[model samples]
Target: MLYIQEMHEGMKVAGIYLCKSRTAAVTKNGKNYDNVILMDKTGTIDAKIWEPDSAGIEEFDALEYVDVVGDVTKYNGNLQMSLKRARKAREGEYDPKEYLPTSDKNTEDMYKALLTFVDKVENPYLHKLLEKYFREDAAFAYRFKTASAAKTVHHSFIGGLLQHTLYVTNLCYYFTKYYPILNRDLLLTAAICHDIGKTVEISAFPENDYTDDGQLLGHIMIGAEMIHDTAKEIPGFPKKLESDLKHCILAHHGEYEFGSPKKPALAEALALNLADNADARLEFITELFKANMQKPDSEWFGFNRLLESNFRKTGDLNAL
Candidate 1:
């Protein structure tokens, strides 16, 4: 099968792909078309059935595996497809694993590394809370490891939540060594549990879409609530400690405009917020390079909306 990332202009496309989305549209001349987004593990691409009402176009919708025959074309510097034929793939006709994106790192290894940090937490209440979710709660542990950090953006693949958590935790660990003022246990605990609410915010793979709770409350609020509820169950948990920890999660985004419910109030909260931003931006840029790496001759990849600037590779050091 041809992955979306491997596709180029003027290539003929024929194979099964996951239909991530499908919508009807009308052209200026009133011609009907079906705007579709096709997906595979590598990534997704835009597709269109220009003649939706014409014969040979099969019935299918979002979330179904589709068999398509089309010509790859370029529109406004992006690759798109002009489909001639399409149909809903029969059950067992295609492999489901090929359609979902997955992380390159092993999930188990990442989880174990996270537990090492948990072992380091000296605060009894915080340590117990970490164990309640990561070590003792079998179902939550499985979901946390498997869930994506977001529906899109950085770390949007399987094992993404765990991967992001580990990266953030590593950064937090370094902060504890360099900055003696920041509470090590609080910072590390906040980092590990930062995006745990994503397990409920975004559904598991195949769909990987937002749930009702995700749409209504979002991961930030959901996560804070989860932390509060869990802490209440632990005996002798301090009230001030719980508030401080929740503040870190709520303000991790760092600003109100960025979806943070509050700005960082404590030194530890500030450090966690900065670390989260750095890791997220780094991952986002890495994904940008990977997606556009197909163009070997081009130096400039054009402007990135996420980064708010144009980007170019520095090329190999050996060549220099």
Candidate 2:
């Protein structure tokens, strides 16, 4: 199969791909075209179907598998597709794994490491809540293992939630040593559970978009509600501890403008929010550099939202 990453100008491709998005619009000259984004494990490529009304082109919604015939061309130094013929693929036409992106880390191993943190937690209520979702609840376990951390942004892949959670928990563990003021049990518990709401907020593979509940209430709200309900089930759980844990989840996004209903009110909440942003912004900035490096002989990079300004990495690191 001709992967998008392997594509070059003038190469004709005939293969199956997942249609990530499809939009139809008329040009100023009145010619209609199907502007599309096609996806595979190598990442996404923009596609232009020049003749949308023709019989050769077929209807396929986003998330549907499709077979395409097109010439790969360079647009702004990136490879793009110009479709001569395309149609929605029939069942048995393509492998499902080929379309989805996956994490480099082992999902099972990552989950196991997460449980070790649960074992280390001294609070009985926090430990029990962690177990209910991570081990005891079969459905939640399946979704947590399968769901991506985000639709785009950072950690958008299978096992992404596990990877992100583990990273945050490790950071929290170290934070406990530096800041003795932050309670180890409370801080680590919040770290483990911070993004657990993503299991409900985002649907599993082939449809990783926001769910109805996710759209109506963001992950922060969903997580706070989940923690509140689970805390109630545990007898003798400290009221102050419950509030602190829930605050960490609520403020993990950092500010209300970013969907954090509350800013980091507790010390643990502030620590968790810092860890989350550290992972996210670092990944975003790294991708920005990788994208620029892939371009032919490219040197000076330009405005990247994650970086907040234009930057450059020249051919010679020492020359800078």
Candidate 3:
């Protein structure tokens, strides 16, 4: 099992990988080729079949496990594969678990930790709302547990939504302690529900891409709608409280250009936004460093579009 992260330039790639996508394209010289993305739990790498119609290439499609033979090469600072032979893998030929990226943390443990926060919500209506999804709904619980926080960015793995929710919830909980002006219950409740729409926004792996709703409405809008629909079911749910919580979800992105339907208006909404952004950026950097572990500390990875800066590892204190 040669994971994508372990691959290097000039290496011969021969393994079963999930064909994340496949597209046909024509070269300027009028030659036809297939653009493919081969994925495993470690990550994804771009691959190309220069001779798609040749005898060595067999029928395969996106989301199918494929047996591939290729050579690894560097292109524009990223690793890519030039595939020689490819075929649809038999069911027994690959483990489905190996093809999906997953969190290092335990999913059950993270869910339990998230539940503790639900327990801490002293407000009955908010507590019931949390219980309705996290404790009572079996189907939603499974999707929430398995869903990724994003299609490509931070926490993009199985159990990612749960892991990310816990991190942001923990951060909001801490913020409540330091900033007494923030409403503990509202802030924490909003944190727990902030990304709930992601369960529907991104389809489950190995097809962890945006759903139709995701492309049209996105997680913020979808999440606010989920909260509105659910809160309506809770008898005696306070209208003001429901509105505030939904505002937090709609504004968690904190800015108009960032896809937030509304900017943070409440103190708690602002706190939730800060916490969400902090966790996302920190996790993004953590994953970035992990992906570039093979490079020396002094070498700049290059300009990252998300961070809008070139990044490199800092010197180790122990070495100093």
Q: Using TM-score, give the best candidate's number.
A: 3
Clashing pairs in 2: none
Could you give candidate 3's per-residue lDDT for residues 152-243 as a string of tens digits? 98999999999999999999999999999988999999999999999999999988999999999999999999999999999999999999
What lDDT is reached at residue 290 by model 2? Answer: 51
Residue-wise C-alpha lDDT for candidate 1, range 13-89, written one tens digit per residue: 99999999999999999888989999999888999999997787989999999999999999998899999999999
Every model's TM-score: 0.94, 0.87, 0.94
TM-score of model 2 (CA atoms): 0.87
Candidate 3, superposed: residue stretches over 4 Å from native = 296-299, 315-320
Error of 1 at 119 (Å): 0.9
Model 3 gets an lDDT of: 0.93
Each candidate's root-mean-square deviation in Å?
A: 2.4, 3.6, 2.3
Candidates' C-alpha lDDT: 0.91, 0.84, 0.93
Off by over 4 Å in 1: 26-31, 91-93, 315-320
Instruction: Please report how far candidate 1 places residue 79 from its true position, in Å.
Output: 2.7
- Minimum summed lDDT over a 10-residue window in model 1 is located at 311-320
